[model samples]
Target: MYALYYTPGAASLVVHWLLLELDQPHELRAVDIAAREHKDASYLALNPNGVVPTLLVDGQPRYEAAALAMLLADRHGDGAFAPAPADPQRAEYLQWMFNLTATLQAPLRLWWYPGDLQCDDEAVRRGARARFEAACERLDAHLGAHGPYLLGERLSAADFYLTMLMRWSRNLPRPAHDRPHLGALARRMKARPSFAELYRREGLEEWA
Candidate 1:
């Protein structure tokens, strides 16, 4: 069985969502980041990075959320979360997913580590927040132009990844609500059946 090492309310949310979408039989194993269980020796051996959301596919460990999503999508069916490889939008689909990880997710990490790593200097924190807002604004505008999903109409892995990011970003004191379209996109995604299923399995009551 597919064994997913996850931490509830973490990046694992998307992985959980996608696994439910695939309707595959799998096991959800929680790794407590608070107690430092993710950093344990065995977990380190399985995933040297010691990060949560490691997918154990038939015993071999697979880390990295985006790569895991792509692998799962491709394995389940080429046409699942992403379009067929030949589709014109495929390029943008891949681009958005990676861009979310590199550009969008970085700022959220700053929010998590604000006091420790980023908020040391007022000027530095302000600059980081400014850059983060710009990125979110760009995403908001692009999402508004698309009018539903990142790919215009159909849902893709890009939307799943991005929507989860937006949701977490919204929880910050600054909130992504200022970006109405982005907020709407996140709401639409949260309302999805697959998202609800994963949330339930993970015991994420706050997500509802």
Candidate 2:
């Protein structure tokens, strides 16, 4: 069984959702970021970065939401959530995964926590928002041309990651779901029974 340390509605949402999708038996250990429980020594030992989503994989701790999503999918998806190494779509699968993580997720972090830059917060947010929207537009166009899912018709780990990031934009000036194809993709993804379970488990009601 896996032990997942998570904070509701945070980056950990993708990992938690994947566990549900994979039908994996896992334990949820809530990390109260509001109370700084994540920064405590015990949690830090499990995840030195002091972040939500420290997943115990066979007794070893691993963090990073994107990495964890890919790891879980690769290990347990039976080629449904990810393409195998020799599959023709493997490269495309990896490209979308990295794009979602590095391009979309990175700037979103700044948008959420502009203080991390140690400068004018509004200015930082403006820059981050711009970067995020640009990436979103490209993704929206891609979905318009080639998707219901990032890997085309079939869902992959990247779709799970993208949906979680799209949820983060629920309150943005130009939310991700405002884009036609992205909105459609979000609708399809959220329709999955696993997504409803994820929202219920995480106690998230905003986008549900």
Q: Which predicted model would earn the best lDDT?
A: 2
Residues 43-116, candidate 1: write the lDDT tens digits.
99989988878998978999998888877876785576887789898898889888888877777776666665
Report lDDT (Cα) of residue 133, candidate 1.
81
Provide the lowest-lDDT 10-residue window in model 1.
Answer: 116-125
RMSD of each: 2.0, 0.8
What lDDT score is found at residue 87 in candidate 1? 87
Residue pairs with clashing backbones, model 1: none
Error of 2 at 83 (Å): 0.6
lDDT assessment of candidate 2? 0.92
lDDT of 2 by residue, 76-168 (tens): 969889999999999999888888888888888998899999999999999999999999999999999998788888989999899999999
Task: Give all candidates' CA lDDT scores.
Answer: 0.80, 0.92
